[model samples]
Target chain A: MTDSPIVLVKPVLPALDKLGAALHEVLRSGVLTNDGSRVHAFEALLSARLGIADLAVCGSGTTAIQLACGALGLSGEVIVPAAAFPAVAQGVRRGSCTPVAVDAERTFLTLDPDAVAAAITPRTEGIVAVQTFGCPADVDALAAIARSAGIPLIFDAATCWGITYRDRPLLAYGDVSTLSLHAMKLTHSVEGGAVMSTVHPIADKVRRLRNFGIGAEGALPAGTNARMSELHAAVGAVVLGEADAEIVRRIQVREWYMDALRHTEWLRPVPFRPGAWPNVAAMAVRLRPDAPVDAPTLCDELKRDGVHARAYFTGRYRPRPIGTAGPTPVADELGKRIVCLPFWGGLTESDVMRVVDAIDRIGGGRCHESHALSLEYPG
Target chain B: MTDSPIVLVKPVLPALDKLGAALHEVLRSGVLTNDGSRVHAFEALLSARLGIADLAVCGSGTTAIQLACGALGLSGEVIVPAAAFPAVAQGVRRGSCTPVAVDAERTFLTLDPDAVAAAITPRTEGIVAVQTFGCPADVDALAAIARSAGIPLIFDAATCWGITYRDRPLLAYGDVSTLSLHAMKLTHSVEGGAVMSTVHPIADKVRRLRNFGIGAEGALPAGTNARMSELHAAVGAVVLGEADAEIVRRIQVREWYMDALRHTEWLRPVPFRPGAWPNVAAMAVRLRPDAPVDAPTLCDELKRDGVHARAYFTGRYRPRPIGTAGPTPVADELGKRIVCLPFWGGLTESDVMRVVDAIDRIGGGRCHESHALSLEYPG
Candidate 1:
């Protein structure tokens, strides 16, 4: 087989005809932003599909999380998982709160409710939990802890679009959940995000906060410009309309990788709970403790074969430990071992087999043998 | 005369063929954002046109200012003009700094060098000045004051895209300048902004700051997702290429309104200094102290005539006054009396005339009589 480069993610553009019609409609309306009709329509469509109420679309996922934190008036200390993206910590800091890092569970790689329960204090204002790698967090347990502590729970569900817990939308778990529609996600809007809230008043506050805090009465509050443009909304409306089909395709690709990698002793896939239905936003594998090669070495080997694999979340999320919580040893270990494989809707079964074959060759034995294999597989 | 509803601002969409072609390129490239090629191209094109050294495109004008402030490492109390948009103050606050409101010059309606000078203290970290309504501020004087104080100056040149001071770009006035390309601006992306700096280091920092502060080494700083999408950048590139022509067209529209309203006794246009080339981004009329109607009353009458006139500032920018500076009486008064009229490239000389005629009839006599005059112009 001829070696071909595989990217970790590729955005699936919506059908050209539908996208063109939406763009034309935007041009005709002559309203490019400020919660225009396209934004409203996209919001309505997403809310209906997600079986939620009061979905507010904004510029990007980070901003959605930031706005949700701001609307909830989060301050003092915010508890977050150490193994998440840097944007979660950045959002907490942006919302004028300090981040307290806690470890993720070893098996599922989601925020551990026990760690979160131990991290809370009198100064804790909120909890920002992550649905890591589209694996649903223990939202019920987290929510219970937050309620006992009288703090809000904000799910950094950036990669959890179309994901479900107990056969219901995973977004319905937290007080407010933020969804990312970035290009690398399973579904996207070029660059966009949405804040999903069950509370009407909180959603109303988010609506005002995203638009620079200008309410109907011309009064002001602390807000910034997080408004999503009509053009972006138009793209989102089209992509969201076809998200179900895209999810199905991604699931097939994911299953192919899982089946192919089942015989590999050194690589382990992060397991999800039985009742959870994840969008399969990414295909991440963990190197076993006794693996012959580390994640970085394996990634380098893949690179030599024209395959682009990445060591995911290596020192990008954890900053200096804050709050009274202790070090997150599990997250620290996983951060060095987790590697994200190239998985997307466009990948065929052959592509999956090729990737699996490359990994197998690289992990077969000593460094010199892997080097020879890489040379043989070069394009 | 038939009553025709006029909006305050209308975005001028690029030619259908060109815009469609640009969108197709975005789809083909499959790179939605994260400093894509289109964003780089747009920045280059805009920098060349504006004659600036370093230009960074971002999500919104507010984010541009916030990034500039962050790049400058601004903290403590920063001085700002009271009559400017709320985004200015919000940007300062978002940067973890405090905004000290100061008065504007009565005639120029831009930041007063004297007020800014008086507002400075040992704790003052920077100065944020505005080029109000495309009118040039006393850039040299303000720069001199900042230099003497050893502080950086940031110009909120949001509405001054095509504006020039003494035949030079208005952006050259400050240490860093921000431009808005919102749909309502003279030249726009669907939603975008740019930060221009003569100092390359500051500009580089801003570029990093806008993309979550992830440097090449993977080290993170305090940053959020302020990236402009490729589609928005493509729109910006096309709009910027034809900006000169758009500016020319808008100048004609501005001149027609100015000449038509020259005879009005109760309304006065904000004056621009000689040797300045203003972009005419907005058409604002100040109600003379002896005018028969207040700004709100006039806006109400105009609304009845199917014209949307709006009160300009209306207490949006001011926060609890800080520093040793006195109250901004001039900004306080102007905030109530200044009204922005409908203006855009789509408006014709006839539309200007109709607006002028409605204002004339409304201001000529008793307020109740104006209602009768508005009723005569039906849809």
Candidate 2:
């Protein structure tokens, strides 16, 4: 049998064009390195648009998280959601902290306040609450839990751009929030991220850590280089300038998909809270019980039809030692059912409709449904 | 008094036109993110040129070292030079290991072989030997020490690009060697580095660690994103492509500076071993007793004449600990006295002569030296 055509995970046309233009300027100046004019401009633009005062651009999201954690002096136990990407937990681990896995809230695939509260121990120094699928988690609630416990909270807002609650940006809530501008993000800087902090000391420390831990006028501290170059910053600047329009388009496409799948039994779109506007970074749907299909089966069928769907963050962060806690209830539940459909700035309503139609066709006992149903039912 | 004229650190005119063209293509293609065609090409070209098969590209020299340490599973005590860049020690510490600072050989200004032998304890898992100032160190000696002790040796050869020893590339002698292609290096890739290993397994592991620990076919280990973008890689490829001719020019400039200052009383260039072909990355000289100027004073005088000389790793890694065995003799001596003059592909012989003339005037205590000496050394 012929293998199905591959749909690119992220067809990053806008980023490519913007980055290309940035590269042209880099080429023109023959100044490919340094915290040059373009990089400085990007940092300023990103900070202003995000409603934050201080932002130091760095090499990648991982680097951003590492910088923040290193600066914040995160060394003991860090509470992390088992439902999030592996990078979050890994960042904590890389910073010499033990990642104490926390359960997520079933309603929204985010860190459960109760789980975070329960996981807090004398060793707990920080909490990494990821804003899953672009939906801003209950930061106010999460912050309360962390503050009362006297631990810092880091928002891995990699997926939650263009989101605001109560007229303030979602990222404005945390002590330090890390934003990723990868090709897959609503606004991309090719490969870049930033650590935003209202605290001058934290921001200053982050700046030093990002630049090999060197104080502005002194020698470097014991640290690795995590700097974002001028080319990346230039691309980030252009993307930030164009993101508003892109977000509008993404929101429209998301609405179109929601409308088409509202009555479909197999596909249940994850609910969002009122007044919580997201960038539509991804459209996630949970498989319903009465549905004739399961997530993996439906996903495989959709791929056959050129409607790419992914099991985002599935098995990304496994539970500790297998039998210890077994698994976080929310992580186990969400990992098996949630699927992310094709989403990007260039995605059209037609593409969304095609995905819905494909899912509608494959809702029956096709492919892996029998296997999934057998597992779903205990024999 | 009017401030001295600010000289451009790197007058990047030769490749400006080409860069503009590359940026134009980037703008058109919109493939702005990781391992784009340019980046892939650069990596392939670099691997072949460096004569290393197991090489993985990353965001920076610091990231590269971290990846190497991660790949090698270094989690105990890492021995490094006390007179090297702080990043070396910091990178080791970042890996959750204790950074044991060892004295370097005073002659080579590299890691002291005897110091490495002494720093080894039950916890010592590896050694990070830096090839300071683009000159290949006594790698054979360091290699023998690491091999005899049954520990891995990671050559922090960030500054040793294009240098050969014993008719073979200096990088081939170590278990794994890392190269920096930062904007400051002779042939930079804007901001990038690579880890090369002769052993296939370690190389494969290095590749995975740098890229979020995702295996070729298995699940990704929890790792950070340390990928080098195509745009940066493309720039690197162009530089590497022209490296042969570029190396010749840089070496010629090095020889020119050496000849111009052959009779200077106050500063003596660091001695190179016979058959030790250096890459001429940076020109450094020791402050002589008869000279009327110190390193800082001479640097100031040269800067006023459109030359940018820098203090070479002064107090970068120092003051080991109260009970720790103190400084490496060669590294200690050079760390205090060595000052590097401008060395880039863009600098002409005439520009070099101008720099030499400025140094000559300062050494003779003609104009700027008297003022510099007072401000720099207030005693």
Candidate 3:
């Protein structure tokens, strides 16, 4: 069934020799994990590359989010953007906090700072802002709201490792910014994540939390083995060496889709915010309301055309967004029609043209079976 | 600081050629994680080797424990063995359940079935039994208690991959048996774990929980990214081939220590259950109260002799065991004076003799400083 010639996000890895060397070093050291020297090396490299002083590498981006929530001592309600991978909300739940989802602004498709402030109640302990598809959230506005509410702000920077705004890294904001180093990300340690923050104490807490809460004195109240293995760190170190090139290639791929779909009436590319650079985790395209075919049709047609595209996060929102706030029209509209096209580095112009050719043959906006519309990503 | 020649558990890895081929295949196919083909192959291989039909490979042993609790629909208080690693209770807490730790039986240092049965209250939801240092728990008795209570039985079988009792793998009992394929264990996937069970549905639930709760149709209520990467699985597959030989070697090392220390009055080997076989995760020695310096001094002395030994789980219970039950004398006795010797596969008879020689020069039991007794596996 998965015979598609091209798929969404074919990871761009380092040269085989670099990865092999890293693996060899891990094998030689016999320190498979437990925040070993290899993990330390990767953390240092990531810190230097991202220009952040405090960071903790963990098992996955979800683990990074989990660590942040755990370190912050958050309880009660955590405000989350409706338009995100459900894992963002799951992170909150895993930390023993309730997730109160709110709508994102139409312009950037990020958490609406106004909605977030309005959603805050005495039960709210923190706010979780997600950079969807590498679209930067309004960090300054969100930070202001957090300060006013006296709640910690956590940015799920899973997709924006290289993203920047006004020449400052988008990750530099928030009490804790969690990054995904999964294979799908521009820079990954095979399967790992990091909890980055300017708040040194929080970063320290995350370290303790990841190591089963064991500190110098003794075991803390709680912690889990959310540590990155040496092998994974080796992969991350090797991958980080080529991250810049990979990010640039990803941008090029995004542009290829954008340029090819510029004149097409059936679909449109999601635009970036001003002075906000993107890492383009997913090159999402919005199917026009007047387009002949709906999202599932476009997804099905693309697959038939030997292209593997996904309608990401469409199920989490649309047909009534799942959250505290009711009637999130902007999120509903965007969520129901969004389709992430085949995107990744090393994609040729010809591949983009093939994807574009398939999209141009859109039909009338007709709904398929209800089950087909329930797209929540490889569930 | 880690310059000791004989440390606790220098991981026995597969040949470089085998590991290299496995990693090369993972690199060849771009699926680095998310239970890909490599993970499937490893799980299949593990199933065949361990003689289990239903299982799920996850991120770590802790994740395996977490998945079991989450899958069993546990919430409320959970019964845990005080003699196990602190992670067992932490896993219960991560599953949003309160850990009601009870003392293990004095014999095998495993959860006493009677104690477990007594600990069960109206609020109790499940039981988490840990196979401390590869010693098999009274599985039949524990299972019977769990069945009587109508609560699920989950064994934190982190150290008993190759261990068997009554001609059956120790993992074959319980509602769900979790394994830690950590580098310190008999067989490892670099840093991996598994949930094994005769209850097929629970195994299926664990698979979903590890995968962000996303299933064939949609998202389940709660889940986490506890996924084993393809690289890790590749490592596991290669490592499993040599696991039997590794187990045999580990058993040999255990025997060597036992033989060398047979007549020593200072410290002696902990006894194993009659029908139970051990994988020998740690060759623990109980320091006689009347013998030479306390566990810390012994540990310090071992280190001084270029043998890096550890006092595992001493801190969590020694001063005062952390759990619902108050003042557990057996746990206190076992937890305070127990020290695990430098034990692992590949330890020669020469190494055993050296360790025994150091123990032979035992002094009167003395507590130099209170700070020195806080030995808990590198904090």
Residue by residue across B1-379, what tens digits does model 3's lDDT show? 2334777787778778778878988897878987799888888898998889898899889888888888888888899877667678777777767788788888788888878877888888999988777778888899899899999989898988888888889888788899999888888988889999976467678778887777545565458888999999999988898888888898899888877776666577878778888646788888777654677668887787687777765663221224665445677677567888888788889888777765664331232123232221122
Q: What is the interface RMSD of candidate 3, in Å?
A: 4.1
User: Tens-digit lDDT track for model 1 on A26-137?
Assistant: 8767788888888888889888988887788888888888888888877688998888777887777766677888888888888899989988889899999988888888
In candidate 1, stretches whose alpha carbon ends up further than 4 angstroms from where it belongs are A216-219, A316-324, A365-379, B216-219, B316-326, B367-379
| Candidate 2: residue B338 Cα off by (Å) | 1.5
- Residue pairs with colliding backbones in model 3 are A292-A363, A292-A364, A292-A365, A293-A363, B292-B363
Instruction: Write the residue-wise lDDT of candidate 1 on B328-352 in tens digits.
Output: 8888888778888998878888888
Better of 2 and 3 by lDDT: 3
Return the TM-scores of chain A for each candidate in numbered order.
0.92, 0.88, 0.91
User: Residue A365 lDDT in model 2?
Assistant: 34
Task: Give the per-residue Cα lDDT of candidate 3 at B192.
Answer: 86
Q: Over all chains combined, what TM-score does candidate 2 have? A: 0.89
**DockQ, cand. 1:** 0.45
lDDT, candidate 2, A165-246, per-residue tens: 6778877768898888876687777788888876435666766677666543444432467777877777777767778887
Which candidate number has the best lDDT?
1
Model 1 docking tier (incorrect/acceptable/medium/high): acceptable
Better of 2 and 3 by DockQ: 2
Clashes of each: 0, 17, 5
Candidate 2, residues B1-379, lDDT tens digits: the string is 2234334345223356575566566556666655567766777787788777778787778777777887887777888877777667766665656677788776657777877787788878998888787667677788888888899998888877788877877666688888888877766778888888876456566556666664423234335777888667766766676677767878787888888777665677877766768656677677764457666666666776667787655653343331234655665566557788777666667776777666766665542354343232122
For candidate 3, give the lDDT of residue B337. 72
Better candidate by TM-score, 1 or 2: 1
